[model samples]
Target: MAKPNALHTLAELAQNDTEAAARELGRLQGLRTQAENQLNQLTQYRHEYRERMQAVAAEGMTSGRWHDFSRFLDSLDHAIRQQTTALEKAEADLLAGRSRWQNNKRRVNSFDTLIARADAREEKVAARREQRTNDEYAARLARDNASRLN
Candidate 1:
C-alpha cells in the first residue's frame, strides 16, 4: 500500500488559511463600499445645503444666519474629509487582504503539487514491483516445462 502523503496536513492548513483570507477580503470590501456610500451621501447633502443657502442669501438673510450657515458648512467639510480618509484606509486594507489571500492560495497549490508528485512516484514503484513478480512467475513456469520435456 502507498504510504500517506506527509504534506497532506500542511495542504489542509494552507487551504484553511486561504479561506480565512478570502472571508477577510470580502469583509474589507463591504466596509469600503459602505464608506463610499457614506461619502456619496455626504456630498449630496452638502450640495443641497449650498443650494438652500444660496436661495436664502438671495432673500436677504441676517448676518447671524450667514455665520451659522458657514459654521455648519465647515463642519460638513470636515466630516467629508474624515470620511474620505476612512475610505482610503479601507481600500488599502482590502488590497492587503487580497495579497494575503493570493499568497495563501499559492502555498496551497504548491502543497497539492507536491502531494501529486509523491503519489505518482509511489504508483510507478508499485507498477515496477508487479512487473517484476510477473517476470519471475513466467521464468519458473518455463523451467518446469523444460524439465518435464527432458
Candidate 2:
C-alpha cells in the first residue's frame, strides 16, 4: 500500500485540477451565454426591421427605398444565420467543458477515497502494534514475578 502522505499529495493535486476544470467550465458557459444573447438580439432586430419595411411600403415608398430595404433585410437574414451557427458551436463547446469538469471532479473524488482508505489501514496497523507491545510487556512482567516467587 502507498503511504498516506503520498496519497494525500495526489489528492491535493487532483483537487487543484478539478478547480481548474471548474474555472474553464465557467468561462465556457459565459461564452455560450454571450453567443445566445447576440443571436437573440440579431433575430429581434431582423423581425423589427421587417415590420418597419412593411409599414413603409404601406405608406408608399420609392423603388430605390424599397430595394434598399430588401437588401438590408437579406443581409440581416444572413447575419442571423451566421449567429445561429456560432451559437450552436458555443453550446457544443460548453457541453465539452462540462464533461471535462465532471471527469476531473470524479478523479478528485477517487483520490479522496483512496486517501481515506489508506489512513484507515494505517490506523488499524498502529492499533495492532500497540496491542502487541502491551501484551509482550505484561507477559514479561508475569514471568519475572514467577521467578522471584521461586
lDDT of 1 by residue, 1-150 (tens): 335555888888999999999999999999999999999999899999999999999998999999999999999999999999999999999999999999999999999889888889989988999999999999999999999999
The runs of at least 3 residues in candidate 1 whose Cα sits more than 4 Å from the true structure, single-residue gaps closed, are 1-3
**Cα error, candidate 2, residue 110 (Å):** 0.9
* lDDT of candidates 1 onward, in order: 0.93, 0.91
Candidate 2: 10-residue stretch with minimal lDDT? 1-10
Q: State how far residue 120 of model 2 sits from its true place (Å).
A: 1.0
lDDT of 2 by residue, 1-150 (tens): 556477788888889988999999999999999999999999999999999999989999999999999999999999999999999999999999999889989999998787778778889999999999999999999999999999
Q: In candidate 1, residue 138 scores what lDDT?
A: 96
**TM-scores of the models, in the order given:** 0.93, 0.90
The best candidate in terms of lDDT:
1
Candidate 2 lDDT score at position 110: 95
The TM-score of candidate 1 is 0.93
